[model samples]
Target chain A: MSEHKNHISTYKSQILVLLTLIMLTVLTVVITSVHLGPFNTAAAMLIASVKAAIVLLYFMHLKFDEKIYRFMVTLVLAIYAVVIIITFFDYLYR
Target chain B: MTGNTSTHRLPSYLEYQGKYTGILGWILSTDHKRIALLYLYSQLFFFLAGLVMGIFMKLELIAPGQQIMGPQAYNALFTVHGLTMIFLFIIPGLAASFGNFMIPIMIGAKDVAFPKLNLFSWYLFIAGAVIILIGIFSGDGPPDTGWTFYAPYSLKTNTNVVLSVFGAFVLGFSSILTGLNFIVTIHRMRAPGMGFFRMPLFIWSLYGTAWIQLLATPVVGITFLMVVADRMLDIGFFDPAKGGDPVLYQHLFWIYSHPAVYIMILPAMGAITEIIVTFSRRTVFGYKAIAMSSLAIAFVGYLVWGHHMFTSGMSETARLVFSFLTFLVAIPSAIKVFNWTATMYKGSISLEPPFWWAMAFIFIFMIGGLTGLILGSVSTDVHVHDTVFVVAHFHYIVFGGAGIAFFAALHYWYPKMFGKMYSKKIANWGLIGLFVGFNTTYMPMFFLGFMGMPRRYYDYLPQFADLNLLSTVGSWIMAASLIVVIVNLLRARKGTPEEMDDPWGGRTLEWKIESPPSLENFEEIPVIDSEPYELKSK
Candidate 1:
């Protein structure tokens, strides 16, 4: 418990991550405005995923956390990915 | 054990003053235990309300042609029935009441992470409950939009759809906060040496359930908000007029709802795990497997929500994928079922009331899950979709799974909670009546459903009359059985007292304390030096 305090990331890395997230969100909104045909929704979601990664890694502090915490986050994301992919497949095939 | 000194300093609530005795103290007090009692009383009220609605619904179908009520009234009856049972009865009945009382004690903590938030959650639950009841009485009409509150119909309906859906939205917020509190408490507040695996199975199950509640609840929150927006403001998320897809609504609803079933069952499963090992007088066969299966079920449960939409014109490939995933989810459930059964084999088994409920849970849930596989098959589900079969399948799991498990836990923990033992003889009679009445009530519905009796209908074809008559009779019997169980428990509060701690020779830390324990739970936090359910000391 004592070691965890010193191991916490400094202020600079936090600022960098926040900046990156803002840039990604702006890029997503811009992409949505442009008519990319069927690719618009996909492009928006991909950018949103990038933003989510920054939040998970920095704001939630998963980057500097133990391996088990990383495993838990990855496991939940994998399940979500499977459900989304399967539902999309159903939509496409029908 | 110094009896005189102990009685002189009995916990504040237990001091038997004549002024505020019996039910008054239970309903009016701020003690967590008494508040839990309040939740128990209110939940029973709604359970009986739902049960009466169910009886009337079956009665109406006895010979069709609006036998008991008009079509509009019938619609209101079934709509309120589903809403009351799901939101008001089963969801909060087991988890909120029992979880609030036991989680703090189980994990060697004084109270939940946020004690005021705990009380706030209960008040919010009661507020939602009151709104639903007001909808029932106002005669502006109860919500006939079904518990799902599917749109287009929801937007146009003159029923109390807005009030009921708003109630559900409020209930979701309450559930989310409870889950958040449990998550933080479990992670941060375990006693000095109670490691991850060292915690009781009930705690692990609550840990898993809290995650489901946190993750899945937000989706439903967003879905309900969208429904309100569409109905009140004509926002176009689910309106086909605005090019919004209605099927997308089903997707979002089931994504939360399927995991919501796990949310209902997981804590009950945790309760059963504890009951099984304690009564069998043996270690659980696969402790880690049972724990991990809970996590597996929670994870796999989210992916299979699509199976609910199989006949809703989903693509063939999507149907096939959901079908496979649904079967995959059942595997973890099967693993849990087998592990519980194996724990009983070659071990000293006691036929206590809790164990009886546990055994019944296994029997009925197996039937429910197996029939679910049939529904998971794309072709068969198309045949039975929206029929009485679907209703019967769901009731079997919800009633037989969570409902039965609730009874088992109540019986298992009654001594610890009240410091007195119930009459096992009467409880046994209650169990038999419940089993007989339950099967009689639900079994005929499957046949009627296959014969094309649509659910949520006030009137039905004359051909299905006899089965409806049988089901109504069965419901009456079930109601009678429930009354008997409640009376027996109430009577137990005055009977002969038992030895204070570990009445059942239980292994968990909870039984290590005095019955109806001190408010802070343990006088000293216990260090875990061995796995749970290890009967023979090493």
Candidate 2:
């Protein structure tokens, strides 16, 4: 029940995060054009994951929030990862 | 305690008038108890609707030659029945009604963390139900793709699948919000000294159910939207001709639905635990075991969705892995079942109506759980896939496990909820009919299914006619008993409220309050200092 003080990002940090997101977006499109063979989907998903993390940490303020929030998010993502890996069992074998 | 003393007693939630009067007061009130009642009445309405549809489907199969309706009508009947029962009735059934009513009081809090959001969730539930009904009546015909809405046929069917799918998507939102609200309430609103371990087992089950509801529902929500898009916008999500893999659709669908089974039953197990502990007048035997088992079930439940797709063209490796996971999931459930039985081992047991319902739940759940193993194994499941055996197995779990547990909760909490005591004798009689008739109806389906009778058919072969006829008669008996149960409860509302606050001598925090608890639940918030179910004899 301890309410942590709200954290506001400085303008410079916000601008930097936005630029990084833009660069990742450009890199995603450029990488898709390069055709990494079996790694194409993997490369795109990895970039998307990084961008999502950045947005969550800065815009969603997970970095400033209590550690429990971050732990919960990681738990959810881990479960999702397991589900996806289980789904790939079919594709990989078939 | 005397600081806020008044000459008159506080008004119970039912008697309190608010900004609006009459039904408006009920619908608009942010009271958790009123919202729970809203869910209770609405669930009953939908349950009866689904019950009638089931009887009609049974009647159609009475003689095995289209006794009541043709194939198409039969299809529509079962589809709507499945939609209504699964989405509108049982999925949100116990948790929304009893959870909303009891959670705050049980935790020694005034209300949930988000009371307004709780009421809004109910609105979303009704809105979703209305949209599903619109899909039924206003369409070219009711969606005949079955409740599963399997692809290819779902896409090709002339019936309105989009509206129904969209309706389910909306319902998913309601489910998610309810889950989110419950999670936050449990995390933030416990009374002082009420640690997670000290909280009631019912709350623990709800915590597990909320996590499942929040995490698993969105997968199905997005899947439903994709189905709608496939039907309306021709996006080819599940359409094979358009290069979409129908099996992928099944994957996404079962990813949520398999966990959805836990969502339906975990609260049920929790309620039974409370009832058993109260009636037995003993501390629960394996408190942490039961609590941890609930989370275990929720976690393991996610990995077993592939069992449903065993025959749906999944690879051998995936099928084996899923089958193994399915069997693995049963260990935690068995842990819960064992814990409940051991709790009553050497205690002062009261054979109350609620206890009877709980006993029936265990008996039926054992059958359902054992048979689930049969269905979980890929070999046996391939034999009974889409057969009546699968139907019988799930009915025992969902209907017998969750549905009967709902009745048990109603009976256990009736005096505390409505401030009136129904006749225990009549309730037991109703249970007799329900137990006997429910078994009669579904038990034969297992034999019929093992004998190769498929489900959702308007008519069956001559060999299946006799058992089908018996099952139809069982439905009639069940319907009659439901009438008795409903009438008995309704009649009791006219009687005087019980003088004792704790009619059953229960030990939970809810029993410490006045019957039909006052608005805001507590005049002075209680500071918890003991265990949830510590009996005096102990």
Candidate 3:
């Protein structure tokens, strides 16, 4: 009810976002075909994250929505990051 | 007129029994209080089922070799026991039952934000339980893998791992929905003047627990599905022969499970805080510290899952880091315990059943927590990793902390929840018997584990037999005590002669409402005008 008017994104914005997501997906597939070895996963994740940010901001409307929603997403990502790091701590070190 | 009104009150939640009719009214009801009672009835059944399994297991242990059940049967019983207790009883224990009942009332809401979703969660829980039961009958054999259902054997065994694990996964969904409902309810539903800090410590703890239930459960849910995938499909997710590491399964399982421990205990801790402050006639000491500590515990709990895997062939550095994190998580827990003690100091106190249980909680919880240090250390855990010590330690914390605290909440809120009063004298005797019985059953296991008796074994050497017998005897006493407690409460279900609001002189918003609460939980939403837990000295 705290309104800036639940901003509905325009169709142009939606189409542009969709195109960008498709381009990123193709780019990730092309990149993975080449062995960047250690950087392969890192690069893919980075690009995929950009795609996620675009989707979250535009499609999910976290961009125009309240700041709290954005903070929650970041916090969730942080928890998953921690889980991955701890798991790899055992695998890589061992 | 007062007598007539009292007698003709239309049976607050229990007897009026909503719109539907008979059992349909209960299972189909959207009333949060009715849904809560539905949970109570169902959970009590599962609780007794788990208890019976314990008695049977203890009987089998009374004399070394199999007495009443076969070795395979023993495995099934204990496995079912763990599943029933963890999933069916404790995980949803306080939160689903008392949380559903109290949260909306405490927050001055009509009902939970999503009442239909709450009913759906209960139905999901029952459906999950039924699936697990079906797994027992339909499987090549009963699920013999312990509740952990650790990989390799879990996948290798013919016992219905897929269906049972599916059951557990379904239960996790139920837990997540309840958690989601509580979080939204708390955020959106508080009375006009109530701020976050102005809310009771119980609400803060429930807030912490909801986050855990929402976030942590998904990992276990995914893990179980991976198990199902590996079992049904040719997925080599956990089978080493199929090119997967079983350790990964463990890492995934404990990642959720370790935090899930708090999912059970944090709410119990909150209830303890509420009861202690109410009866002691004191404002809670370190209220912010206790509130923040719940969050700290939930946050830190996730990091220490590796401690459970220290001896699982994890790297030395991983072990060391997890060991450190394990110890780190304990600090917030210790802070809450200390704050509870400080709140009771130099305060006028009433020794109610809840208080008695809370005191015993601190004692048993201390034993459980201190022993956790032994398990937390990289070197010490290697010695007692799968021994009876771990069992005793777990039972102490889970059963003592959550289980006894459950009784504390039951006794503290009894008159309010049911609008009736039971015999406090009988409650005390039951408490004494339960306390003595509980410690007797589990204390020897610390020695048995130290003496090198491995857990999940159907038989033991002659040396461990005597202690096992003593533990079995303790089980009997505990069982008798539980009957007395349950019977006493059941008998008091009839409406009481006395008026019941603020019976414990509680300062929480729930205390301001009528006993048994209205269908909407409030005639009109109350305005919170003061801080939670303020009590006048008697």
DockQ per candidate: 0.69, 0.90, 0.83
The predicted structure with the larger TM-score, 1 or 2, is: 2
Q: What does the i-RMS of model 3 come to?
A: 0.6
Encode model 3's per-residue lDDT on B1-538: one tens digit a residue: 0010122343567666556899898888999999998998898899999999999999999987778988899999899999999999999988999999999888888899999999999999999999999998895877999999998889889898899999999999999999999999999888888799887889899999999999999999999999999988969999778879999999999999999999999999999999889888889999999999999998999899998887788888899989999999889999999999999999899887878978988898999999999999988999999999999999999998898888888888888888889888999999999999999999999999999999998899999988999999999999999999989889888545578867787777777667877677665677666677755412
In model 1, the clashing pairs are A90-B318
State which candidate has the highest lDDT.
Answer: 2
**Index of the highest-DockQ prediction:** 2
Candidate 3 falls in which docking quality class? high
Candidate 3: lDDT of B75? Answer: 92
Q: Per TM-score, what order, best first?
A: 2, 3, 1
TM-score of chain A of 1: 0.82
Q: Work out how many backbone clashes candidate 3 has.
A: 0
Q: Each candidate's chain B TM-score?
A: 0.94, 0.98, 0.97
User: How does residue B528 of candidate 1 score in lDDT?
Assistant: 60
lDDT of 1 by residue, B220-295 (tens): 8888888888878888898778988788888888989899999989888889989999889988888889999998
Model 2 pairs whose backbones collide: none
lDDT score for residue B135 of model 3: 93
- Residue B67 in model 1: shift from native, Å? 1.4
Please write out the lDDT profile of model 2 over residues B348-435, one tens digit for every residue.
9999899998999999999999999999999999999999999999999999899999999999999989889999999999999999
Which consecutive 10 residues in model 1 chain B have the weakest lDDT in total? Answer: B1-10
Compared with the true structure, the alpha-carbon lDDT of candidate 3 equals 0.88
Q: What is the lDDT of residue B336 in candidate 1?
A: 89
TM-score of 1: 0.92
